[model samples]
Target: MSTGSFVSAASVENHGVVCDCGLPSPVRRSWTRRNPDRRFHTCKGRRVENGYIDCGFFRWYNQGDPSGWQFLALLEAREMMEEQRMQIAALTNEVTTLSMNAENDVKSKELGNRCEALKRDVQVLTERCIGLQNVLIASTVGFGAVFGVMMLMWTSNTA
Candidate 1:
């Protein structure tokens, strides 16, 4: 008899969990939670019934490996990582919008100031024109007013 040399299916299937040969075989159990079920097979060769022509083997089908827990853990980790990535993207978008709004505000204020300066310059030029016109009208009264013209009528002045 080969001792410690035969390959146990549980080791290869369950990551070295205790083999069911230590327990019984043809196992089927249902518990709470999603109508959860478990099924597996071990190599401790149970006998079949009488009038059976096959060997001393019980074939148990529909038995999945013991990867349910590990797969769940992996799925949870992936979901957490995806949530973190979405948060980062949302934060990045928020930061970009804030920065652009700040820049636009600064530019708008600068343009408003420039427009005010141009308005002030136009007002100053208009006031200067009005003052120059007033000065010319007053000087023309001294040189060619209606009374200075009467003096020129005293012999057509320089004629």
Candidate 2:
């Protein structure tokens, strides 16, 4: 990646550097491994969408590349950045997994509670059915005893 100020042709006219295509060159910084952060000027012309073409002008804006120690430091910084990015991705995945697990746990608890409530309802209904059956048995027995007594009294009167 390179960084630089976008100087228009008119703005850079005072610098007296112009490309073969009659356009003032723009100053840019290089971020490659060989020239990390070195500044340079290149042609302002760019290739059209139909074909590749440019003035191919190039010039160094800075005098020299960084020292050996400076280059090593840049490499270390790049590696550290990559490691940090990987760590961030791993943490993000863990958070998503934990969130899903928490949601499932809540749902499971709710289902368990609903099951208990249904079981209680069933128990109450069974008890009510047993009570109704007892009442029906008592009613039938009482009716039979009353009818036998009436029949016995009428037969004795007739005799």
Candidate 3:
């Protein structure tokens, strides 16, 4: 393909390996559905563009046009990649769960702190109410004693 991302370092090993070009033959994978995973060596300058230039240098890396071992290797690589993707998904889920738990803990602690503050306020208000009740009782008794003394003085004068 025109895209070079699939190019392998193994391709460089083919440099001067067996090419009549006496130069490198970069390894390239076939993308056609007919031979979906086949690999081959071709001239480094071969183009799949409008020019479609080729140096007439070609060789199949897979034996007998399609090798059983190469197909197995491709399957193994796909399986390994799938396993890694599953592992990453599991780790991501764990991180999200841990984050939610941490948030819950912080919220719980804040609620407990607010409840404690309210309890202290209630206690202070109760103490002030008791002090006010005591003051009212004392004032009532003083007024009653003053009234009794005034009645005694009126009866003594009337006698």
For model 2, the local distance difference test gives: 0.75
Local accuracy of candidate 2 as per-residue lDDT tens digits, 25-121 = 7776666656665667777676799875778887777677677887889768767887999999999999999999999999999999999999999
lDDT of 1 by residue, 72-118 (tens): 66556656877999999999999999999999999999999999999
lDDT by residue for model 3 (1-159), tens: 334324443444553444565667766666432343667787765456676555667787665555476666776776687799999999999999999999999999999999999999999999999999998898898888898899999999999
Clashes of each: 0, 0, 0
Compare the candidates by TM-score and give the number of the best one: 2
Q: Give me the runs in candidate 3 sitting further than 4 Å from their true place.
A: 1-66, 154-159
Task: Compute the lDDT of residue 90 as modeled in candidate 2.
Answer: 100
Model 1 TM-score, all chains together: 0.49
RMSD of 3: 7.6
* lDDT, candidates in the order shown: 0.57, 0.75, 0.71
lDDT of 3 at 5: 29
Which pairs clash inside model 2? none
TM-score of model 3 (CA atoms): 0.54
